[model samples]
Target: MGADRVGSGRGRVGRTGAYAVCGAVLLAGCASMPDSGDLRGVESTARQDTQVRVFAMPPHENASPSEIVQGFLEALTSDDTNYETARKYLTTAAGHTWRPELSTTVLEDAPETNAEPVGSREEGEEFVFSMSGSKVATVDAQQSYVPVTGAYSRPVHLTKNHEDGQWRIDALPQGVVMGKSDFQRNYMSVNKYFFASDAEAGQSPQPAAVADPVYVRRRVEPMTQMVRSVLKGPTKWLGPVVRSSFPTGTALQAEGDALAPDDQNKLTVPLNARAARVGQGRCEEMAAQVLFTLQNLTPAVDEVELRSGGKQLCSLTEGSHADAVAALTSAQEPDYLYFVDGDHRLVRLSAGSGDTKAEPAPGALGEGEKALRTVAVSRDEHTAAGVRLDGKALYVGALVSGGSLGDPVLRSEGKTEENRLTAPSWDVRGDLWVADRDPANPRLLLLEKGAGEPVEVETSGLDGRVRAVRVAADGVRIALVVEKDSRRSLLIGRIERGGKTDGRPTVTVRELRSATPELEEVTAMSWAGDSRLVVVGREEGGVQQMRYVQSDGSAPEEQAPTALPGVEEIAACQDDQTPLVANSEDGIVRLPAGAQWRKVTEGTAPVYPG
Candidate 1:
């Protein structure tokens, strides 16, 4: 919607040609007026007529008064060239006064006004007609062509004409003038090309058909520019920068808990308590890698050398101790090493390209000279939990500030019943749950902050001895593997806050089946989700099977029997996304979500390689 004007005349028109021609025509019809009496009657009738017309009209169905105004303005500025449809609503005099020759096309639409109505008054109205265009006019005889465009509009005053059949409208107000220029003419051409082309009709243009490569490059240029902008920040670049700086192959290590298989040869060993190890192993051991140390007995020196795929990767003594720990603990891309020191301090190490190292012993345990027994790192590695030899459990411990062994941030005592302490499993919320060994009155001890004594959760109806205990992610649900009368079962029950069991903490059990149609002994159980559990068991034939049980009774499912390989021990990683299994004679293997089993690390002695 635009217009333009060009010079037409070279000299200014005389007064007669400029104003008299239009004025005479307008005033000619007004020369004769009706009688005063007739005028008053006409005015009264016209007032009633106007009122009736206004009342009969429906309420403004459009959005708002401002919207109506904007719509009218848009119609006026349209490129349709004919504005009669938009001008029909204005008074005759207003239309005549519009200077189309002086006005230019609208460059941009202005924001609508927020002003609301405050009533209206009108003056006398008059009819007018005029036409004007650009002219090169000389006021002082020197001729110069001056471009111009003009429009006309009529204004009507309603309030002042209440008593008479008369209305007044001056020429269109100066404030209503819209500007015009050559730039607007150029924009008009662009607008026409954009709106009137076959490309706008969804047909590919000829240029696009001829140069596919250039078209693709142009299409992708904007996205590439945006990516460059996003990567220009320090924090934004930090990730890739660190990755590039450290690169890969940097050796690092940390000490953490490693799960080992229970030795049936040791009669005093707890059935569920597997051997724990503390020593250094390579960070890349895909199998269960555990390190153990006997009092004054050095591990086989040959074992210290790093090996991969039966080939030596590097000598252990070649790297600094700190660097070795850093590399071993770094699990970036799934490389991890579990270490055990001579003092029985356990550490888990992941070696990536970076210099980050985790010292599970002192870093998480805080200022402690105590030996660490069992340690577990969550799937995210942000959380590490360990049990001290003092029969106490420590958790939420972080690595030392400088990547060295430091004290743990939080410490709590293990569950103790009748002067005997039992190791506890750390829940997602940092709470610890341990099973009491009392056969007649077994219970689960819950240790949370401010609770002096462990909250006893009765396990009477579980139908067996509680062999292993685990808490759900919510910390309110407990899962126990019960060996009931030679049959194995999984018991799930909620923990009551006040220790009252008025049907709130109801317990449910599901039997695990062996290949021979008999209930198999449950070896381990881990939560897969809010309502699912992954259970591992050994059939009579010694074949290992993993079963997924839905707590909500949705469906019972099981994975195909998988040979335990050389591994005699198995435990589910706390993460439901990946199931963690340990081999007594090999190493740890991670069964990733929806993927085949892969080795994570190799186990150390006293720590079965399984």
Candidate 2:
């Protein structure tokens, strides 16, 4: 620990600079040093305040078992491409057996090491070390980040190497472990775009790109790794609901160097020959997919040029080919925001004009044929569905000037109002979704084209009764507010569909995971963007608040939306320019970006087209 002594391994200048800084920080306090000296340039590897790279230092001669464990932990946080230096401290067998790619366990801070006293009769054993910490979250092999809460403790056994007489880890976990701050510095989350199946694999007149987010190393040729991750297809959790535009077996042309955007801010992607066979239209879509994925990393990328086998296939310009890959949520581009007026009639405010005046929808439902409780507009804005104010029935009608309302499309068998039908939601495919709260036969129903016979969609792995439902614009995911024991939790589920069974298509909601597990109650929620949602909920013993959460149960980069008190229902879309409308104590309120909420009208259940 002498100031003159510097550690060496890999000869990294940053490691040396780090030691110098540590020495300065210490000597500046305890020991008296020259306060003023001739300013001189020193060898430093850090180019900026934030871009400091930490390099791993190998084990010192005859280090203790505790020191070995601590050094290994630090190595996990270093920016080693292949982790070859980190593995140097381990015995050949232990190094060969370790697998750092399986998963990542993030803790609140560096794990503390404690060694048990060696009083055993065994002649050769050195020590048994325990590494423990407060758990924060875990990243799975699929690279999905899931926040967790618990205590983590693990044992590490070390024995003297027969050949080198050095203590090495003989038993340890397979994956890497690091602190949250280190994890943030080492990894980043990015969304890879894919086309939605729309409940059918190959049957759709149109298309929209859905986001599947995954985490990857930040400083280690991330663009190259991301290209491969996209070609590998969606993660297991999201795979069933979405389909990638890239063909199977498609991969980046192998190159040993890092892939980076060029001087003109354009990226040239070389793909395998599989991509060369695609038609012009399909190839452009492929370029769009890559462009979308890289946008999360390098927003300034102006274009993405795709090539295969030394042949130019196609190119996608950010401004010109942006529509080549449409965001599932904002595909239709909502023109009006819908809500129920004080008179219990469906009304809308034109989004383009930023109009505050409310006008009755052209349909009969808007003409007061039936007092409305809640409403959902189709993604196309061509149709509307409404639940009865009494919550007994659901009906669909057009939003045109002469549109007529029809008989109830679905009915709830619930005996009381609280046990009746929930508000309706429309997917991008124009299907209507609602939950029947009948205690005897509680069910989730879907109507094709908003007017077909209602079918009970399966809710697999569900633990509570669904209180409300909102379908994503991709039409393959659904968000539910499930109630159990007087508490409501928000869960995101994948919608799975099968071939027709007795002339009816079979549908199921699978793998319902909590989008807001930290919250004790979720009162209202809506699809705010592709793979993002605006949620109104609260933690245990905490007051209610509104925030944006990823569909995969991760926190979004954007902070909580403007907080409005008494929010009963909240609505948002992928378009940030569009104001967020909500039903609050001030009646119907609209919040433009960076502005306070203004009363739009006296209404409830303000919603944009999903």
TM-scores, all candidates, are 0.34, 0.86
TM-score for candidate 1, residues paired by index: 0.34
lDDT of 1 by residue, 293-350 (tens): 1000111111223233333333222123322232211111223334443355545444
Model 1 residue 343 lDDT?
A: 51
lDDT of each: 0.31, 0.74
Candidate 2 residue lDDT tens string, 519-559: 88998998776667888988989998998887777675465
lDDT of 2 at 573: 71
Off by over 4 Å in 1: 1-344, 349-368, 376-385, 388-423, 438-442, 450-452, 499-518, 540-542, 552-561, 566-579, 592-596, 604-610
Worst window of 10 by summed lDDT in candidate 1? 207-216
Clashes of each: 104, 0
lDDT score of model 2? 0.74
